[model samples]
Target: MDRATGTTDPGGGTRMTDRLLGVRRCLAAAPADLLLERLGTELARTYGTTETELLQVDYRLAALVPLSGAEPVIGAGTPAWRCFDHQSEVVQGGALHVPVTMRGDRLGVLRLAPVPDDPERRGELAEVATTLAHELVAVRPGTDRYAVGARTRRLTLAAEMQWELLPGRSRIRPSFSLAGQLEPAYAVRGDSFDWADDGQRVWLSTVNGMGEGVTASMLTCLGTNALRNARRAGLELADQASLADQAIYSYHQGIQHLSALLLELDLQTGVVTAVDAGSPRLLVLRGSEVIEQPLDDQFPLGMFDGTLYQSQRFELSVGDRLFVVSDGVPEAASQTARYGETALHRSVRRTRSMAPLEAVRSLLGDLRAFVGSDLVDDAVVVCLDWTGRV
Candidate 1:
């Protein structure tokens, strides 16, 4: 370990672990606002890549904007955006664009000019991009630069709470890849999503609270935390829902209720245990066929005291994709009619070739286009692919 940098370099050889630690060393001392600058300096020192740039996906999940507050906005279908969307390296016009991602979260891209075509170099650059992503997640809460760079508009207090409450927009694992997002980014309320993977299983939930604004935000917060508290205590699906239901009921005294869908996927077996408490919707796509995964309807959370919840079991094959959405997506209103079943089914099928992260984004984009304007209510969408790979 270097006493100055607080990072270990086992021998002087240029191993990937050593290089990753070196990047961590640079990040360890970097302030939030200077993380990208420090990363650029480290990359230059180590790889002699001086023209590297960090572009972060904005809050709306639309485009990639430079973290350095510079020019050259990268939009969808461009090299940088394609790199981000596809989560791969793209070389165009003598520049290499690499996706900077942490698990399922699509952060942005790292662009390096005049790079070699060597496989080792590609691996190292990809690792460096991933390392930067992990560091950004750690340093994000401490700095405003990340948030500011990603936002094109101010967030309402409700939207702010909803955004902060999310674990991330996407997650990738050996067994599956999951991605989720909420709509009306600037002022979303009442709708939120959460997930956790503990190697053995992944727990996912979508909450839809009553009303709008801060009141709804707070209600959602209370319900989500209650669910979290139960899950963290090692409770099963039914108990987690039951506890959250009680908490909400106690808080609102039956005056308010929130709908939720809680799912637990066994990573090793592909078995799913679910609890459906009122709103939100679930659909499974298997072999080009879209089917709704049915669950017995129960009272919404907080509807009444001592409401018992039951868990239903199902299984997902390796090639299956599951979509869980709040009512906002299916029920979104247009000038003529609702963005209903036919449109929702078509939209989901349209994204069949894309990744989970891109699928959710495309679905929301379709919703926006169908509505022809900003959404009147909050919407949330989560997509999970069961790869079941060892």
Candidate 2:
């Protein structure tokens, strides 16, 4: 025990502990707008830094919006995006940018300035930023200030409902990587993808529910949840699809339908069993080229009360990829030119070397750009890469 510093070592362990506790203690009391502001202040006081700022990646996919301080646009070819893009810190002359990511979502960048000259403290600074990111994720479900910061425009009720039902935007494991993207972020309806990895298998589904706005969102909700219920109840892949079809048909009756691909994948062996309901062919990317995996197509959900959905089995290699898309991809009109299967496959080949999230972004981003930045209908792209690890 040290006398003056109240710690065993001379590295100010006790002070750091006190500051961490202080930040946690203040977290519960601060309002949304002031949340990061307080964290920055506490960090500055503890680290002897001149200034601290937090920048969030806006939902528009363009600039980095600030929660409290100055708004900094991530200029073209700038290093700022590298912080969020690469999940690594960017250290410069006076300012340092750290990626504040939790799981696979690139939340934003934590920027601190007038950094100390000591190299030994980099880890400590990074830990602080990382902890803050975790705290933000935990608190976000109860508050919308972070969403307020991230949004570029007002979100529609249907888009909000759809987004609320989604899992993490991306997931990465040693044996596999998966990412999903939805377009018309502010107004999308009923286009959703969900997945789960239960050690032995990964369950995946992509659905496009019929109708518009809230009605479409409700139909999607019913379909996705019914599938989840059946799967979680230990039903087979075919049964899961059947249960979803039954639920939607029983409630919505004729005319309300969904195009879907429900799958069960063995994590260790790379085997895929799928039930396609007006679903596009599963595109498998091996090495640099993308190929379509053929499947026996079934009826879309709600098309019939007694549609017999069958499971088709296939095996994937170590580097194989799985792609699932809604009808929006092929139907999306860009200059009166739809995104045909050939172009979509070509785009995947072009972005094969990028990270899973980057690949999804590239695919969706290209589609949006081609359609003049406004997709008339909802579009989704789900990518999965199997690394065949033990």
Candidate 3:
């Protein structure tokens, strides 16, 4: 309600209410590019400006992306420090200058040049800039909303590509069930889960590549494709591991490593076969007892050619559960503590009595509570249960 910065409207509540409603509409819309376009149009119209530009901060690249209606006067990939150093927004003659900021973060500066005769509209334009900044912060990206409009289009496209490669929410068969979830859903990278069934056997793999963003995503994509091809060819667990390792080595030249687990389940005998390579530990639950699978220090996938991997076999009883996960689950840490094996053991025990899908949901909930937030790394959980009735 600070009128000095135009936080409150001159006519009191009506204009402010309309602006809030507009923000709500923006939030409800699909396609971030469209939303940003709409926001830019509204800002230009409301401020009576010939042009309005939005700039966003890219933390990964340490640069700003410019959202401009005009071409090339100022563009994306501008240095953040230079903008701050210049205290950007002062125009030489007829141009208006305004900085778009939210909380203490400077999203980007807005440049609007008015016609020569309209000197009186500067305050109105400044007010609009302030309101827009607040609206950006309140809706998406929270404290960094100013950057949202600038990065929305490209990020949205990338998110769509990521979604296209992901598995369904749940994969159900006559004998078992599997499900997974990724944290910070819109920006997830470096976590992938895949499953293939050849009628005689079911093969499942979960992989977490090092680091994040496009590079990690590409590595995961390559490994996932290799896994599918190897399994479809009916390669034995060791052969499949070798093939996948060769593919990774050839593709990345030893630059990346994938913490992976490849599981094969026989539909006829209810036997679970697995190969664990530097992954987070897998948990097996029977009755009231929870046991960790013996990983035994195998090298991660893609590390070296001819690295031998051995498969471990377990008999699956009715109502028994298998929990496969990426490090994102067990390694999730709050400011003070890590969600270690002990916490995971207790969570799995508490949910041992639930249906496979419900148990997976409960386990993830418990993990989130332990971490105190969504995990920083990509987290994935694949739960398999043997429904004795099948």
* Per-candidate RMSD, Å: 4.0, 3.4, 15.9
Per-residue lDDT of candidate 3, residues 1-390 (tens digit): 444443565545434445545544554462433445565566555444565566554322223466553332333224333443243445545556665554323445556656324343454445455556555555543333334434433443334445446654455666666666555455778777787665667787888778668777777888888877888787898678778888998887778977788888887777888888877668888888998777656788889866778888887877778888777777888889889888888888897656554466677778777778655777777778767444
In the predicted model 1, the residue pairs found to clash are 104-170, 104-171, 104-172
TM-scores, one per candidate: 0.92, 0.89, 0.58
Ranking by lDDT: 1, 2, 3
Winner on TM-score between 2 and 3 is 2
In candidate 2 the C-alpha lDDT for residue 289 amounts to 76
What tens digits encode model 1's per-residue C-alpha lDDT throughout 211-306? 879999999999999999999999988999999999999989999999999999988888999999995889998877889888888999999999
* lDDT, each prediction: 0.86, 0.79, 0.64
| Predicted model with the maximum lDDT | 1
Model 1: residues with Cα > 4 Å off, grouped in runs: 1-21, 71-74, 116-119
For model 1, the local distance difference test gives: 0.86
Task: Report the C-alpha lDDT of model 2 over 219-252, residue by residue, as the tens digit.
Answer: 9999999998999899999999999899989997
| Candidate 2 clash figure, as a count | 0
